[model samples]
Target: LEKKIAHQDAIERNAIEGKFGEGKRKYGLGRISARLQTTSETVIALQFLVMNLEKVLRDTFLSFFQIWKALYLFVNRKKYTLIIEK
Candidate 1:
């Protein structure tokens, strides 16, 4: 399970980097095609941009918040009230 998780993380990172690094290389062709009005596609370069950013964002919410919730539940599962006197 640990190995599988690590491998998935590496693949996700590589995909993110590749998509960001050579995005314009791929999109330049699309831009040229759009200029020529080759088709009605609008070259969703912005969509790809948001998708990559969203991966990191979604990972963060899953990892941090999920763990935090579990920990909070474990820690405060049995809450007790105490009177403070000073």
Candidate 2:
């Protein structure tokens, strides 16, 4: 049971750490140069916000693409059958 719990914790930690790593690598989280505390906080907050928004946009686009692809295949399947019958 302890090992299971440790494994689960590691999984969660890796996910959180991966997000930070992604932010640092892709979103300039590591390059903030603000000297003021408030400015630094604001920059970090904005970077996180942008990351979350990007995730949402990507998920939404993928969902839409999947739905569109399904509809297209369904329509084409019927057309294909009709053409074969003729």
Listed in order, each prediction's TM-score against the native is: 0.36, 0.76
Question: For model 2, how does the per-residue alpha-carbon lDDT over 1-86 read when each residue is reduced to its tens digit?
Answer: 99999999999999999999999999999999999999999999999999999999999999999999999999889666654453
| Model 1: lowest-lDDT 10 consecutive positions | 29-38
Residue 7 in candidate 2 has what lDDT?
100
Error of 2 at 39 (Å): 0.7
Task: Please give me the total number of clashing residue pairs in predicted model 2.
Answer: 0
CA displacement after TM-score superposition, residue 78 of candidate 2 (Å) = 2.3
User: TM-score: which candidate is best?
Assistant: 2
Positional deviation of residue 37's Cα in model 1 after best superposition, in angstroms: 11
Off by over 4 Å in 2: 1-9, 82-86
* Residue 16, candidate 2: C-alpha displacement in angstroms: 1.9
